[model samples]
Target: MSNEQENPLLQYIFNNPEEFARNLTKIAENSGKALAAYLEPRESGRVQDETPEELSLAVKTLAQVGEYWMKDPARAIEAQTRLWTGYMHVWNNTLKRMAGEDSAPTITPAPGDKRFRDAEWEENQFFDFVKQMYLQTTQWAEHLVEGATDVDEHTRHKAAFYVRQITNAMAPSNFILTNPELLRETMTSNGENLVKGMEMLAEDIKAGNGEVKLRQSDPSSFEIGKNVANTPGKVIAQNDVCQLIQYEPQTEQVYKRPILVVPPWINKYYILDLNEEKSFIRWMVEQGHTVFVISWVNPDERQSQKSFEHYMQEGIFMALDTIQKTTQQSTVNAIGYCVGGTLLAIALAYMAKTGQKDRVATVTFLTTQVDFVHSGDLRVFVDEEQIKLLEDRMNKQGYLDGSKMATAFNMLRSNDLIWPYVINNYIRGKEPFPFDLLFWNSDATRLPAANHSFYLRNCYLTNNLAKGELEIDGIKIDLKDVEIPVYNLATREDHIAPAISVLEGSHCFGGPVEYVLAGSGHIAGVVNPPHKNKYQYWTNDGLHRDINDWLNTAEEHPGSWWPHWQEWITDKDNTLVKARKPGARRVKILEDAPGSYVKVRL
Candidate 1:
């Protein structure tokens, strides 16, 4: 179990011969050349004047090359294989001359020392490489042997793409030339222009002034100031198992219609309460809306046996009960983000199926999907075999580690995250930029083993929820029965939740659905508020007439929809009860703010 004894490369090679041969070849070549030229120290050994400098330069150059190879390794190994074989031949002749009478230095590979084993593994991998080449060559030869026929353009293009994929996988190359032209043509004609427009928009965002703005007409500024003032203060409220920690809002400005905020248990709630400058929670409170967000308990190995049913009962349902009690309201509006949204949808479906529709007034979803068939790239992580492997690992560990979930997200955007760091630190000799978001992103949380298994099998792999075949607690839930007004936001450029996959699919909700195509990625789009030079929103319904009209006609808005949303929510505010602090008899009090469970990391 010690780090020193752990051989990642050995483990990988033993498990995957094809990958080992494809990777070990490069490591072998560099070590071979470096070891071959190392002369034995002697009094008459004439060292060159610039020998040290030459070695230093070679070492530095090879190190730089190593960083580049790490990103697209298949090709690097192939090149390294060729280099190593050449070095081995030269080294053999040198050994013969150096050891005429005396024996040469023993260079036995023990499959544990990185240097010796690396070369040895590469030598063994050559047979695998030859076998793979023969198999592929045979597959390609079959097409030629049958005599090439005139194939349709579509079929030919598809064949060519597969041919290229296989060739790239086997032959490997450091420089990968992508044909974006084909991808461009596949997108809608207007989409091509939209991409260019987005680039300009991104440039504008990068160039925009970050100066603070003042609004004389806004009554909400005082409320936001109050929330900001209490940054280090503790605010806690509880009912049974549901606990609410208000680091900001302590008083109750119970809007006639309250909105429940459901964020993913995988992440902290502070994404909504990020900071005063970009806090959506603060913004909502200032806009005269009562917001209740769920703070999830971070499960440890001890809590690994907890299932999806437990999460629904203890997390979402418990929070809902507390919200109803605190507001003294029969129904409340609901908003769910990411995985929380998916969970909320399941809860809502369950509620409707069991005739509990009076609890929710309206539903709002942010980047959540019910169907997974159209989910892109993420599918690579969940093949049947990989899923089985993941489940087995989770069961062994008692829970799916949070760090593992974080790694998956990072890999989804590896070009933007992992590769840039590798290039900067390893190649360009630069340190990483310190960003709060990246820090928060790296702080991963674990999923209980039982919960993770159910999530993958029921929601993702099966897509049973949207199909109306999903049952929870013996209740056959249907989304169609949950017909409250709905607001669904989808980011145009979200890879995690593609626009077409969610926004277009909202038609299946069978409700008064209002779909908004926001102008950013998953996180940025949701976090964005109405600000100068930020971005605008387009709706399936008409332009900024009214919430009702906007939900009815497809129209484009030129600016932030923050003010419009504020107007819509406040239109139904009550004058009966002012914002008040709840007494012990009226509302239950819990632990200090941010709670014990919110701070758990792993």
Candidate 2:
């Protein structure tokens, strides 16, 4: 044996290679046996054994689809004729443009499409043909989905989604011949752009292990407590899971009840406190409300054993205790965002079950979901097979890498989030511009194996949380037990947490609920500031079981939802008291706002 001190596992394998190989073979044999047993019944030609009535129903459905298409033969013929005519016109226009005889084309790129923005795209015949072909293909796909009268709505929706993905993937801009900017760069740089791009590709491969780095900003440029998360405050408490940050009051008098923000640990907490101008934390403080945020640690292998219960205990529960003690308040308003909101909901249920209902004054959820039935496109990736694959990977690493999780999220919006950066950085050979939101997005945090696995299995796969089967520290939680008044906000275009899912989550609570639908996606909706005069929101006092009914009956307001939230939260008690400084006599200050934990990177 080698002199090196081998670990027990390695030592055994080294000493008994034959035995290890035999054992491995046996394990594979067992797995194959299990798989065969599972698949045997499924592959037994069950469909072939269907009764005559079932066969007839299947045939009838096919016939109905054919008849529906045939019924509109004349209209379809007309549409086909128009399409051919348009194609011919495009061809003729392209020839004329090439010959320098026409200023305008018969067909043009659609509005908001930056792909064909370069003059060469319209001026060059080959490029114009490519763009026209792509546009026509997408239009045809959309028309097919829209005109399918006999197909079920679900099938049509799924077909449209896949078709869109296909079209996006095959975009001409993704290639060199059709991309004018890329072609120009190649020529002007004498292939230096390609060399530079290769270097960038190599760097990204080394940094991300084959995953592309999409964000345009330099992370080092932005420092915590300097440029980002600069809101003046102090860390009142610290633990292995989280640090409680108490912001300095901007006003002399503040609300008696403080507000605690529970941001998701999946990302850094500085998202809410990006800078002085855009910081939601600063805005909350300036509004004369004492604000406290939980900055979760960027966990690694050392914290691999941490569970969701650990987060509940050392994160929200600990923060709440510190807030109550520091402010000398019996109850306080609490807010949770995304996954943090999910945690907060569970915490509230646990408290209610333990007869601590009076600990929280009001609960606010921002783009959060308690029910996962319609959790949007993300649900498609959560299943027995997928979870098992993920678990195997997590088991090896001790924690789920943030970059891997980020890649999955990026794929959800591949056209917007993934392809754009690929084209800009790899094809065009340009660096991404520094944007605060994108910078914050690139800063992701790892999830400990124990906590992540439990969350995925219990909440996602089995949906135990919604079913009231989710347990933390041996206590089962039921959202219905949460009797406090609730405020829920959902974004209209959020694919991560669908608006309907958020609305459905509100139904879980027994108490009165106020729900608002804000414009934009998950992060943008919550970070919306009133002064910018951007994005509208919808509000309805009544909570209806049907999401559409609520949307239809709701009143639309053209402004940020922050003012509305302020009105709702402050309406209960308008009384203001003298502002209390950070780190009261009870709890000593640990560090400044955006504290040490938030600064830790993977």
Task: Highest TM-score: give the candidate number.
Answer: 2
Q: What is the C-alpha RMSD of each candidate to the true structure, in Å?
A: 20.4, 15.1
| Model 2: worst 10 consecutive residues (lDDT sum) | 4-13
Error of 2 at 278 (Å): 1.0
lDDT of 2 by residue, 1-602 (tens): 54324432231123444554554454455445444544444477421221354344334544544455567888668667766877887778777777778557665667777667877676456777888877876786577666776777544544555556668889898886667666665544445455545555555644553344555566667777898889999998998899999999899999999999999988988888888878888999999999999999999888899998899889988988888788888788999999999999999999999988888989999999899988887765566756786787778768998987786677688777778887777656677787888888888789999989898888778889999999888999999998888889999999999999999999999898899999999999889888988899999978987889999899999979999999999987778999989978668998777788887775
Residue 464 local lDDT, model 2: 92
Error of 2 at 559 (Å): 1.8
Worst 10 residues of 1 by lDDT: 209-218
- Which one wins on lDDT? 2
Q: What is residue 77's positional error in candidate 2, in angstroms?
A: 18
TM-score of 2: 0.79
* Clash-forming residue pairs, model 2: none
